[model samples]
Target: MNIEPTILDAVNKWLTPAFDAKTQEEVNELMTTAPKELEDSFYKDLEFGTGGMRGVMGVGDNRINKYTLGKNTQGLSNYLHEVFPNQEIKVVIAYDCRHNSDTLAKIVADVFSANGIKVYLFSELRPTPELSFALKHLKCQCGIVLTASHNPPEYNGYKVYWQDGGQIVPPEDAAIINAIEKLNYDQIKFAAQDNLIEYINTEIDNAFIKSSIENASFNTPQSAKDELEIVFTSLHGTSIKSIPAVLETAGYKNVHIVPEQAEPNGDFPTVKSPNPEEPEALTMALALAEKTNADIVVGTDPDCDRLGVAVRNNDGKMILLNGNQTMVLMTSFLLKEWKKAGKLNGKQFVGSTIVSTPMIMELASSYGVECKVGLTGFKWIAKMIKDFPELEFIGGGEESFGFMVGDAVRDKDAVAATLLICEVAAQAKAKGSSVYQELQQLYVENGFYKEYLVSLTKKGMEGLQEINQMMVDLRENPMKEINGQRVIMVEDYQSSTALNLLTQEVSDLTFPKSNVLIYYTEDGSKICARPSGTEPKIKFYISVNAAIENVSEITEAEAFLDQKIASIISEMQLK
Candidate 1:
């Protein structure tokens, strides 16, 4: 195999004395025996996206390695010093169960401490949300969590959180990127100042668990909590550290953990992938639920920021609730509780992404709470809270199996979300209803909405080209209709414009510029095509809804939506 000139240039640069012997040896090995691998690794640098930097672990600027992460930390350090000049800059760090996360986290800590910054490092693996809370709880300027979320086992990542307990946004993201781009591998500081670095564990954990309970607990009666039998699986990830304890403190006692997948293993041996969004990832949890006749089943990704839930339907079979379904259920319950407490006076709101179900609007409108739609990242939702401090952020979530109960932990938090769902389930069970029944009633009152997501992964340099071409093709040749429905509107986020296909009218969209395209049908169907910013995949989201007369017509409503989606998918040739 022949390596390209650009790859060879990056390869030769890595062979310098600035790189350690171990890294140099691995690079030489790839050069001689694995040319293709070498090309893949050095083709380009790993860039941060909406969720931050995530990629396979290896020895390249393009991969998640000590050098790349160190560069990021060093750049962050410089940026912090610039932004918070002459102040004592402090930061916190945490890691998940991914391979070498602890080591990578320590490397980052060393970089910060060497730059005369105070560092608070977690002594053990912890969920991602705790890092966000810890940064704020400790009054630090920034935080970092080493995790790849729910990607494959070979993947690891670094996510940065700002002072607001949210991921960096806008000018910050751009400035940090500029700092990192200006530096070379030799400029990163690797020395650790023991006096400046402090190891932390229980202090942050206790505070986070307490805060989670305080935000998520709705005062479900103790009797209801005991009656709500639950099964949970961490998918061999990090949630096992906090979720059970949070549930216990929230008055939930009948919780069962899937023992086989309870241990924090980086390999994620029990499942093909650690993502809870896939039903197969929750197979063991479902089995345990069936064995124990559990009322509800819940699971989380490796980082524990997103959760998947299953509940017994009216027919007595446990069915997994998609992200949109859970979003609607959780938001509705929160709104209802707020109304009962007289917290809703047009001074509160909920959040959803453009790709999420429009039923959120219907649900929020009925309660007189505004629903804010943004780009497809929890970070954007977090931005909403910071941008609108005068109004209360009751709750918010995207269709990607992530939700945040409050702004305490600005990003997606599964630990708190799990507890919130348990409260919902227990409250429903006490009222002679279940999650399934509640959802049916919601459909009967509101409209019946179903959502589907298709993610097509494109790996390596060639694959990136293919994915880019796909988006370009869609934009250059816009679609006028799908499933025999007239296209009423087209919202292109990149252009920041909404084109009304019917009247040829155009209006401006007040959203961040991103490569996303959405088509609105005359019948209220929403079809969105977006390229994922974190992973190398293009996602197509389909949302279709129909009004239901009553709960008895739910089956027919679902069938009609299903047929509509299938026809839409077929017409688009997505499959």
Candidate 2:
């Protein structure tokens, strides 16, 4: 393989004595046997995007290694010192079950401690949301979690959280990235100050569990909780540390955990992908639910930031609810509860992402609560809470198998979400109705909306170029029709403008600039395309809606929407 001059310079730099002997040996071996891998790894530096940083673990400037993560930590420490001048800088650190997460967490702690910053490190693996809670609970200026979220086993990452208990956003993210870029590998502080580093466990765990139960509970009768049969799986992730305990403490007596997946393992042996959004990840949980005749099943990804759920349908079959379906059920139920308690005083709001189902807007409008939409990632939802503190945040989620109950934890908390979802199911069972039945009734009342997501993975340097080119083509060409439906509006987030197809008029959209495009059709169908910031993939989200006045029409409405989505995919040559 032919390598670029710049890439060859990077490779030679790694071969120098500046990198340790083992890293030098590893790079030399790759240069001899795997020239392509060597070129790919040195083509560009890993970017610290707006959503933190994630990449495969290997020896490269583009990979997640000690040098990369250490640089991030060192830069973060400097930024915190500058921001809180003359103050004692304190930062918390947490890690999940992914390979080397523990070691990575310690290295990060070492950097902070070595730089004269106080550090609070978790003694063992913990949920990502708990890290968010701990940062705020300890009054730390910043926090970090070492986990790749739901990505493949080969990947790992670092996510930085601020004092607001949310991921870094906007100006801070830019500032931190700038600091990281201005430094070299030798500037990272790897030495540790034992006195400045503290290992924390039970104190934060108890407080987090208590807050979870309090936020998730809705005054459901204890009798209903006792009757609700529950099945939960952590997918060999971190939620096993707290979810089951929280459920048991909250009056839930009949919780059945999948024994095979109860243990935390980084390999994620039982599933191809540890993500809860995949049906195969929940296969064992579903089987257990069937065997126990459970009312609901829940599964969490490796980081426990998101969740997947399955409920009993009317025909006695276990139906897996997609992320949007679960979001609808959770949001609508919360809105109803708030109304029942006369808490809908127009000073509250719900949150969602642009790629999520429009049903959230409908539900929020019907309840007279404002629906705030942002770009993808829960960080933006967290930003909503901080940017508008005057308005109370009830609850919010996106169509990615994640939800947050209340504002205690700025990020998504599957542990709290698990208990809240079960409460919904338990109450439905108490009223002689099931969650599926309530969902169908919701469709009957406020139109039926179906959402579908398609992600195409493109790996390596060449693949990244291909993904970017595809986005450029879509942005410039602008599809005029799909499945015989007329495209009426084109919203380009990169340009922060909306163009009307028929009138040829342009207007500004109130959204942050990004490489995302949305096409709206006359039939109320919305299609969105955006590339993954942290992964080598591009995602397309499709949403179609139609009115349904009776429960019996659900089956037909769903089939029609499914057909429509399929046709749109084919017409757009997505396959």
Leading candidate by lDDT: 1
Global local distance difference test of model 1 = 0.93
TM-score of 1: 0.99
Runs off by more than 4 Å, candidate 2: none
1-575, model 1: which lDDT tens digit per residue? 87888889999999999899999999999999988889889999999987999999999988999999999999999999999999999999999999999999999999999999999999999999999999899999999999999989889999999999999999799999999999999999998998999999997899999999999989798999999999999999889999999998888889999999999999999999999899999999999999999999999999999999999999999999999999999999999999999889999989999999899999999998899988989989999999999999999999999999988999999999999999999999999999999999999888999999988889888989999998898888888878888989999999999999989999999987999999999998999999888898989999999998899999888999999999988898887
Q: Candidate 1: worst 10 consecutive residues by lDDT? A: 1-10
Q: After superposition, how far is residue 215 of candidate 1 from its true place, in Å?
A: 0.5
What lDDT does each candidate get? 0.93, 0.92
TM-score for every candidate vs. truth?
0.99, 0.99
